[model samples]
Target: MPGRLQHKSALITGAGSGIGLESALLFAAEGAHVLLVDVNLAAAERAARLVAERSPGVQAAAFKADVSKEAEVKAAVDQAVALFGRLDVMFNNAGIMHPADDNALNTEERIWDLTMAVNLKGVWWGCKYAILAMRANPTDAARGLHTGGSIINTASFVAIMGAATPQLAYTASKGAVLAMTRELAMVHAREGIRLNSICPGPLKTPLLMDFLNTEEKRERRLVHLPMGRFGEAIEIAKGALFLASDDSSYMTGTDFKVDGGLTSCYVTPQGEQVLPPPASLI
Candidate 1:
């Protein structure tokens, strides 16, 4: 059988490493022409090479763009269409957490500003241009990739459940993503373009592992997970694959939680939680 994403083109931000890279690879494997977008040109190039190698003749490419910047994001979305004839899926997955985003009182103004700039504003820029690109144009219509596509914004499990782990800026930014995705989905549902958010639980990405470098910190997070382990990037990539394809043709404005049951459990075989959720920090 032909691949699910056959003839589709997908632009994945943050594709240099972690979930983005894995998703690029998986999308290519499923027959989507992949564009690996990253602020780091070299990293995007490296990932493009890997995606190309893994899926021969799949037409993988790389582009440099800081999604937070409007011009760069516009250029990337335009270039993806110009290079591949049309864009069919857009994955907005770049995000970060700062060391100083501990709590509302302790968080610095600079940290909150930077986090929102990159995490929230960045996603808005991507979606804005992606819809512009996906809107059926005379040329795109002739090419058969008419106005309609999937927009997958990466939110987090923390967006739904309050976490004692802190990272207030990160949490707030993701909450904004979930809200924006829902609103946009409703606004565009009749227009053919579908939008949704993916809420991944604690993953074994370099970013999270580096943050939890100490065993004490890792154990604190592990205890909250019903699976008793961090999720793998590929696992979340698979979830993106399902959304990118027509398999989710009826889905939109939904929060797909690929969280290893992390957000669902109240108690487990181990206990109620090695550490209780901090009593509502008044």
Candidate 2:
């Protein structure tokens, strides 16, 4: 049987690690020719190797580029079109959260700039170039080489709800991403292209692992999570697959929350006044 993304082509940034890397593998498994783009050249190549191992003869390659840079973003998209003949999906998933982003007062100017540049500006550049490439293809009505494509941006649960631990810059950047996804979706809704953002909760990716390596930090996070666990990278990958495939034909500009019910519960059963038992205590 043909896969969901049979014969499709995709360009995914941050494909070297975490959610982006997992999604690249999943997309390839679904029969999409994936172009893995990342700032880390070696890591991207390693990911490409893993994909090749899983799906022999799979049309998946890695590209090195900084999504925050317009020239790099344009060139990366151009390369994907050049190699694949057409682009069907674009996953803008590259992002970074500062270690020092514990609170608003402690977040330095440099941290804010870096976070905003990569998280917000990078998404904008990816969308701009991806859309341009997709627009070059003939409209879906024509059914030509490029019949438009899907764009998936990565947001976070922090964008939906503020938490006690404040990463002000990260939160602000992601909030902009949510808005941008909606506006862009409207702007290109008639062009046969779909745009959406995925909002993930605390995930068990390498990035998160590095951040929550300590016992105290890990337990602290579980307290607020209704599911009492961190999300898996594969979970986010599944969300990307849905948005990238025609499965969500009518969906665009929507933010799919992959948080472990973190955003769903306003008050815990423990009561608003009473805090849930600590993860260790439980």
- Among all candidates shown, the one with the greatest lDDT: 1
Candidate 1, 9-49: lDDT as tens digits: 99999999999999999999988999999999999999999
Off-target runs (Cα >4 Å) in candidate 1 are 137-145, 271-282
The TM-score values for the models, in the order shown, are 0.92, 0.91
Residue 45 shift from truth in candidate 2, angstroms: 0.2
Worst 10 residues of 1 by lDDT: 273-282
Best by TM-score: 1
lDDT by residue for model 2 (107-224), tens: 8998899999999999999999999989886444433335678999999898898754567888899999999999999999999889999999898777766767688887767777
lDDT of 1: 0.89
Error of 2 at 11 (Å): 0.6
Candidate 1, residue 85: Cα displacement in angstroms equals 1.3
